[model samples]
Target: MFKAVGKYVRAVWYLMTFRIDKASESLRMNPGVVSANYDRIIEEKRGRINQYKDAIAAMIAQEQQKKDKLKEVTAEIEKLEKLKAGAAAKARQVAAKYSGDPTATRNDPEYQKCQTAFSDFSSTLAEKQARATELEADLEGLVENINRHKLQIQTQMRELEKLGEEKHDAVATILSAHEEKQIADLMTGLSQDQTSEELRELRELRQKAAAGARVSRELAGLDTKQAEAEFLEFATNSQANDEFDSLIGLTNNSPETNNDGPESTRIPES
Candidate 1:
């Protein structure tokens, strides 16, 4: 019993699914529905593309930031190098003051101050240079990524445009197919369309109406009256023809001149 119940439920589910699918298919095939669906899809794609563009914009912004940072780092490195060179120049002048006294040059407070300054500058410059190198690499990567994304966006835009064209073509093709199907159905005499049925009913009604009119005419003795009129017209035309024949000498006597009968001949003397 449980197995049977399960089977029954399964069958019902399958039937429902089938019906839903069939209905969906029919709805999708409608021209207006098809167009609306395409529009919806296009809108969705456009929204997604906009989101993608936003992301690309962010990357471009990041790329610019990296470039700015790299420029700043390079400038700082140049300044540090200049400061280090200045420190070395100051140390040389101090050492020249001690002409031949090497120990005095090493112990000189001014020379020692210049050496310390140069060492600090050298360390700072090296650090800045390393940072500049890192920024350059990051900027290069960002540029490459930005360029690739731009290409992708261009391709997507083209695809979007093509989708627009496809929408029209799809609608046209479906409309044409519908028209052809209707014609084929009509030709095959298998069309069960409501409009076709209505047209047939209208024609039937028209024929019945004509037949009723004929019946009504017969019932009202109008047909007899028409026959009587025709007979009268025939008699009038025959009389007119006789008169014309007599005037043209085609008949021996006109009804108006020989109403009595044949005329008698007169006899002479002898």
Candidate 2:
């Protein structure tokens, strides 16, 4: 009778464990549970990604504005530098012309002209120097801001990386193989979309920057030509032979004129 009772107890214990194992397996493989958990994880990751994307976009916009302003300031600074150089050159030429004449007095028309030109050049140089200083300070501030933005971007990227890792961990822990694969594919698709958008924006920015640079270069070229022409005209009117020759030399050595030689003058190699 005791043996029979022992057998009955062992049977009851085995049956309970079998049911428990079956229930655990059911829980693990349940489609509803897996789907719900997968969705939740994906949603959370997407939310974080969207937040990061928005932040990055705002930063990029701000950086672009700063870049544009920097470009403008740089171009202005370049123009001011050229103007200052021209003024100095003019002052030197005037001084040299007057210096060659020992009989020239302060009251002489040429002497008076030299003094006036020197005074104007000095004043203009001082003004431009001050403006250039201000622009340099502004450029430094913009650089700092750009650096800050870069740091912010780095932080955002790190956060995104961490979030990605967390997403993978969450998926691995809660999802079945099929569900994990689906979520992975979805994430890949979303990532591709984001990458494409970023590429498009970068391309657009590059094109705009290139266009702006081209326009700036063209304007600079025109200004340079105008300044050169004006200087040459002043030299001619003043009968400053040496300065006129120097200006002519500069014109002759210009890339445009130098490259305009006859295309048919090629020597054939024997």
Candidate 3:
């Protein structure tokens, strides 16, 4: 409440003190009616502005969640992209490793080496394709939500613009109701919208900030980690039944093994 009051004083103090005199002088206005009317306007404006600030804060909270989701999805996307690159690199290496020497059937030592590499690359590629598809779908949904929020904010601003001074009169009616039903009349006269104009303005400011937002690009580096992990995971999966003696190198791939700890999970992945 105090913060809202501070903001109100800063936003309208000049108008109330300096500009109001000019308005009264130019119009040869009735000071008494205007002062009474002005009191209501100030209250409504202060209420509305505070409401706007709260709404904007809420929007920002929602946006932060969405961005976190975006980061997760983007991380997955880079992981897949890196997996794609690794799959191709491994494919070339495997073909080269298995090729040049004829008579080396799948049972030959070198042939077995190349065969395992080829299978790992193919499996990693498949996983990459699936994760990339999921990441794209999540990104599309986030974009839709962002657009919906934008439309809502624009509509709110237009409604606020239409409210004008009608709200002030309504507030006056509320505080000054008489035994003759003046309060009831005032409450009836003030529309819900008149009371909410300030809330809308705060939301608009948040929307503007959101619209200018951009995705961070450094997250693209997740590809290398993704590729390496995918290869390790495939090795782990295949070796789960193998006597390869290598222990299927997936220790680095599990969530439990992350530097941030298992409690890192938060927003939905994009």
TM-score of candidate 3 against the unseen true structure: 0.32
| Cα lDDT over the full model 3 | 0.61
Clashing pairs in 3: 48-198, 51-199, 52-198, 52-199, 177-183
Writing each residue's lDDT as its tens digit, candidate 3 over 192-259 gives: 45546677888998887765542222256555676889999999887564433234553535433343
Best by TM-score: 1
**Which consecutive 10 residues in model 2 have the weakest lDDT in total?**
250-259
Q: What lDDT does model 2 reach?
A: 0.67
Which candidate tops lDDT? 1
**Candidate structures ordered by TM-score, highest first:** 1, 2, 3
Clash pairs for candidate 2? none
Model 2, TM vs. native? 0.33
lDDT scores in order:
0.92, 0.67, 0.61
Candidate 1 lDDT over 44-153, as tens digits, reads 99999999999999999998888888889989998999999999999999989999588999899999999999999999999999999898888888899899999999
* TM-score of every candidate: 0.83, 0.33, 0.32
Stretches of candidate 1 exceeding 4 Å from the true structure: 234-270
